[model samples]
Target: MTPIRPLPSYLVQRFHGWRATTYQENRAWYRRLAESGQHPRAMVISCCDSRVHVTSIFGADEGEFFIHRNIANLVPPYNPDGGYHGTSAAVEYAVTSLGVAHIVVLGHSSCGGVKGCHDMCRGLAPELDEKTSFVGRWMDILRPGFQKVAHLPDGEILRALEMQAVLTSLENLLTFPFVRTAVEADRLTLHGLWSDTGEGLLETYDPARGLFHPV
Candidate 1:
């Protein structure tokens, strides 16, 4: 068996620092959380972008949110083929087990995943078209979104497509039977949001208007 090496020195040092300060300062709180277990109010589906900090944005404490992040922050249409589906598994658990009251799909500007989808659709990036490319296959979830924005000017598609990711995820989420049942029973609600990372701006989707308005 391969031996597991010690953590990187920087991470070890950081852990030590956190253990001395933040962990110590909140030891009792941490212990209480451990004993109580988590009962987060919302399940946040967000992008894998390191810059998109979920907890910081909402001022949520530890265990307050069940966050699932992936490339482009996508949630594929519910498919029960007995195949591996990490995102779907997370959603199922959050809705059926955790009983989260809300599900939030959060997208962001300047997303590399969005750009990759755009480029791939336009034939600007062939590598992403290969079946062996995990990213290409995953980005297929957003191809419909591209079709929605394809008619717009080149400068507008990226941001528009970014918002489409949030919308697409929200739509796909309902394809799950558990999620659909919960929503119909008024036990769960879904939301879509997009953030401009550089501008620190936020916008929310309004189904009534079918547009994203800044907040």
Candidate 2:
């Protein structure tokens, strides 16, 4: 990758000026939040997409939701020796350490990571082969989904892949001993959400209906 220059000295000066005003308001909120520490009601697993702001969609503020984000918002099945377990670590802290009651796996339309996985599966991006980069290994969790829906129409495949990823993550969540215990004891609930970027709608899993219903 080509190196990019840092902000011009003047931009840094302007940033400090703007940050001072915002930081003051942030400080007031933090002071109150620090009093009781975080007692979030839910832990959200979402994609690292700038367009999909989970808090804004859910009408939540700080301390209300524990959020974990990553490429394609993946949750690998619990592996004791998983090399880089950033997402799983967050789950451990959120479910065990923080004792969050609900966990939502938020998948979205037109996910870049999902698209990349599809490309890899179709042999469109052989450069990202299993032996090469971390992303290749990281995205392997979606391999089953891709294989299952690869032959379908593009639109159906995309939707199916999104939902499949959410279901897969939910299965992964249960692999964690703490999460499994809490769930079995009725202490935790797992939900899968599909956010439509084009329609700007939130669809939640409906166990009774076995479908994603609008929220």
Candidate 3:
């Protein structure tokens, strides 16, 4: 097989600098983690958005959170059909293997994936309507969510859809028997969260109120 090219010099140099400084400064902690292995208490399912920094927002340290990122942080309902399912595999491992106590579905404001789904559903983005589009298929998980908010005013639709993404993920997570069992047995808890990139605010979903409240 042909060998792949190395990373850019600047990135390599930056990594070396981090290894010499941050790694050196936290050598003992890193060593401990390496020896003990990770046993993170929570699993965070978040969007693959550069602006949404899970660690920075929660001030989480290494090995503190088991994170899974996807286009829209959407969780597909459990389907045991012997197919390739990355998200389901991660959730299974987190629940059965790691025994994570919490599973948090985190969405954020100004999500390109959410916007794309909105556009595609509105017939505004014909490109995403193609069967060959991976993003479109992934965003299909959030279509039910879109239907719920489609009646809202155009201006208020985006934010509502963002929160819906979180809620939808939380709802889908329960489709996994492991997740449902853990939740019912009080071994695990499910949470939904949304972040406002512009306002630098976090909001949490309240199942009782069926609404998101500022955190």
Clash counts per candidate, in order, are 0, 0, 0
Model 1 sits at a Cα RMSD from the real structure of 1.4
lDDT of 3 at 132: 95
For model 2, residues 102-208, the per-residue Cα lDDT tens digits are 99999999988888888888888887685877777778899987887888987688788888788789888899998999999999999999999888998988888
Identify the superior model by TM-score, candidate 1 or candidate 2. 1
lDDT tens readout by residue for model 1, 1-215: 76998789999999999999999999999999999999999999999999999998888999899999999999999999999999999999999999999999999999999999999999999999999999999999999999999999989999999999999999999999999999999999999999998888889999999999997
For model 2 the local lDDT of residue 145 reads 77
Structural similarity to truth (TM-score) of each candidate: 0.97, 0.87, 0.97
Candidate 1: list runs displaced more than 4 Å: 1-4
lDDT of 2: 0.87
The lDDT for every candidate, in the order shown, is: 0.96, 0.87, 0.95
Weakest ten-residue segment in model 3 by summed lDDT: 1-10
Q: Which sections of candidate 2 miss by over 4 Å? A: 1-28
lDDT (Cα, 0-100) at 89 in candidate 2? 91
Flag clash pairs in model 2. Answer: none
